[model samples]
Target: MSEKQYLLDKTLETWKGKRVALAVSSEHSFTGIIEDFDEEVILLRDVVDIAGNKAKALIVKIDDLNWIMLL
Candidate 1:
């Protein structure tokens, strides 16, 4: 893997099962605990959607993410 992917993988490893928020767009973001992930995507559980409502879960492509931060 590239250094970029390696770093991201490391970051995700630390954040796994931790509450986090990832933005897909300026107006779109989701909050949840990281349930699983790979180089391509992340699975978030007990999620709160951009609309601020409960969601069963969210699966986000890594390339589509604007940012991710601890919540």
Candidate 2:
């Protein structure tokens, strides 16, 4: 598979039943439990420090994300 596809697959594989620290563009950060994911983005809960205060509903696109550190 292509590298991008591989990375996305890895992200999804690592996301299951795990917490992650998502570093996005604009120097924003998000730490939460990954609820679900797709090829383009991820669904996160307990989101904070992005759009506003802490929120349980958030969708972070993969292109906007710089990195994801599995925790």
Considering every candidate listed, which one attains the maximal lDDT? 1
Q: Candidate 1: give the clashing pairs.
A: none
**What clash pairs does model 2 have?**
none
Model 1 agreement with the true structure over 1-71: per-residue lDDT tens digits: 99999999999999998999889856688899999999889999999977889988889988899999987
Backbone clashes in model 2: 0
Stretches > 4 Å off in candidate 2: 50-52
C-alpha lDDT (0 to 100) for residue 28 of candidate 1:
86
Model 2 residue 47 lDDT score: 72
lDDT, each prediction:
0.91, 0.81
What is the alpha-carbon RMSD of candidate 1 to the true structure?
Answer: 1.1
